[model samples]
Target: MSRPKPNETSSGFESPRTDEPLFQPSSEVWYKDGNTILIAGDEGFRVYAGMLSEQSSVFADMLEIPLPAPQATHEGCPLVWISDSAVEMRYLLKSMLDPRYILKINQTLDLPALCSILRLSTKYNVVHIRRRAIEALQHYFPTTLSAYYNARERRRLSSGGVSTYFLLANTCREANANVLLPSILYSCSAQQLDTILDGVPDSHQGRVELSHKNKSAVIQSRHQLAHLARTGTLRWLYSGEGCSDKRCVAIRRRVGARLLEGRSIDGFVNPLSTFNDALVELIDGDCCEACQNAVERCVDNGREEVWKKVPSVFGLGSWDVLVKAYGQE
Candidate 1:
């Protein structure tokens, strides 16, 4: 492949940037017989024009434009300059050209790789790749509460916690994956206020901070969620008439007092999740069966209510709006 020197603008094409250093051919995606070279950032990828055109309508239209005689060529093929992140472009091109580059395993993927493919795929109009990337994200951050709980129980969800949520929120916004934002932002609200504001440390990207708008939303939602958890999800412990058993009534008062004091035994932001089996056992062991059943019903109802309000709490309108904006799949 012919290596383009620094600051050389190809004829009949506007270079994406003029100050970029010499373009380095990608060792992974460069093919000896490739018919076209794609320049992203300071990296060059030699790939078959036909393959790209076949998978992406954007590429198809761009490749169809005829160049003047003696057009700029890298090696013996056409040079196409693209304004995209080199790392992301490499991930997108590798996924398209290499059969062995698996995008997912058990519906889970590395966050950076998944985000890269999603961004470039959406930009380049690669429908299948974009769909797969969205599906992988949905596996971890589902729209419905039941799916969220199921993934949580299986431990198959992303383990990056608040950091991961911050990344997902930004990526989904850029990729126009609006449906995934509610769950992602809700997860972000579960973290400490300081952590959210200070940003999460990322090895490759440095400290990843939420946008100013997102930071404000997450902070407001955090306080609102904590309040709701006590007043709503665990309301049975405070306002409900316990069974005639004096002991059951006492247990309710004790737990409710502790919760009001911001002393959650489980330390979970989601009130519904905090009332796990262990907490249930603590209450049920002393209370009558009827009281036990009533507590469960209250928690379930509260969880549903909170789930319904999540999108609005984060300023994303409603689930109906989000689903319509980004079709559920």
Candidate 2:
């Protein structure tokens, strides 16, 4: 696939002084082959289609050179390098001519951090050349990486959940929860939820939807599931975050306070889309405190603004209103 196209201007890089080397900046460019096009650094990172220019950018960093951000991106985005060598890395960080390139240092140069770039490519909406570059980076990791480098699965059978908490969630949901509850809550097939929920704490009331009750499991899981909610997965199982099930509800309840205020349903997310695609668009478009709170419930951790928005949006209203607004999906 062709690299993603970035808007370009003649002057790509910013100016320089005696201390800085004089390097000419080029606009984003692309070269097309029969059906495919490749974007090179000379043309910025832009391609015929939306492909990321990561390879060229990272390579430029590798060559002790810098690539200016094209006109297409937000100005605040940092201009970072990936050099691991202290001399090279330090010089590269200090050599940054663009003040806009904040974070002056490279975060990852080791195998693990470099490999994470692959995951970042998958997470961010980068495509084409950028995606290809990420795929190539994966080659840096050995086919048989060490235990940590290739720990593909977080919840292993050998180490899945807290024994006590697992028992609790099992017991809580199975007994009181409809055998059909997981399906209703997970947005997954009945069998999937059933299989997962089946690991209940021997004959507890039902799935331990409440957060406090399942503390052991969270500990056992090493917060991996919660991390999935925050970063790994986009499709949150429930109709929304809190309403997904008891565990989700408890997570939010436990967070205890609102981090952001106003109709700003701004919560923490890598892309921020997993939680509030609607919050930023809908709430930002226009939302009352109540609607904001209700929307705030989308966060998995159940932040304070979210709780406040929930009650304000629904709790303040009649039972029907509350049901419609805050009722579990």
Candidate 3:
């Protein structure tokens, strides 16, 4: 709509009267319909319908309200992110809490840089970014996410409406628990897991920390399972997706039968591995078992040193600790 016309104009237009009361300036641009602004000072040409002071307040410790858009070309649709000095406006736009802001951001950003902002948005409490970032991150970093499906960065991510959890889940379902469990356990809740345990029977490890009545029974179940695992009654073997279903209950019966199996209500995670290894697993570690099996053969051939040094091929430092703690684990 056009701005309201000024009354009693003999010349062109007179500025706000100097003697006017402090509260009643003759030409206040507090609202968006004020005719036009010349954009005083040397900031260049533009027309906005709000007070300059109001625009400055959006960045400074001054006013509390926002201004109408000021781009010369689009009028009200200001592309606040185009200029470096407009950083305040950029941040404010990033935090607008509206999903549509992404459309604007996407117009100006590449995928990786976009993902970074999406994550930043989540960290800054921008709700829409939590999900958008996950999708983009997983799409590009799928293997990393898969191996670390339960890792903190992926936890509650889907819950946050990111929906990219499936990307990680698809790739992580088959890895060895001993090798991949720590990454998954890093950020997930007790219930958010199980995809990682695929075929393994519930260890009494299911504590009822949050839900009391059921915690003890679950714990008992896990401890029994872990006991069987520890005693070799439950020989772990890979069968694709999760745990092997065939001899699972049989193992439970043979070993955990005498003792109630249970573990801490919370699932356990081991010490973490290298950043690259961890990221690789979380993204996609489906072939890890086969890879290790080959390495074992090399070690059995009296090539332990050769096998240990193999990690250096992937730019790793040492496997001494891995061999010492859970060799071939």
Best by lDDT: 1
What TM-score does model 3 achieve against the real structure? 0.22
Candidate 3 versus truth, CA RMSD in Å, comes to 19.3
Q: Show where candidate 3 strays beyond 4 Å.
A: 1-112, 119-124, 142-293, 296-329
By summed lDDT, the worst window of 10 consecutive residues in model 2 runs over 182-191
Winner on TM-score between 2 and 3 is 3
Predicted candidate 3 versus true structure: per-residue lDDT over 1-329, tens digit per residue: 12222233354442232232212111322224433323211121222324333333432231223433222222442311112212222333343423465565534343324433543343334444444543444333332333343334433433222222222222222211122222222222223335323322222223212122122323333433333233231121222223334444343233323322332334321112112332233225343444334323322332222233322322323444422333332
lDDT of each: 0.75, 0.29, 0.31
Per-residue lDDT for 4-118 in model 1, tens only? 4533355544433324444788888899999999888768899999999999999999998996554656678777778787888998998788766744422445666777788
The pairs that clash in candidate 1 are: none
Q: Candidate 2 on 1-329: residue-level lDDT in tens? A: 22233333467653222233221122222222211121222122212121223323433333344345441121232222221322222222221222332222132233222223323323332233223322233233111213212332321222223333233233323332222111112111111233343443423234323243233332323223333333323232333432444444444333322212211222322212224554454345444444345555444334322222222221132323433432232
The lDDT of model 2 is: 0.29
Residue 7: error of model 2 in Å? 61
Relative to the true structure, candidate 2 has a C-alpha RMSD (angstroms) of: 23.6
TM-score of 1: 0.80
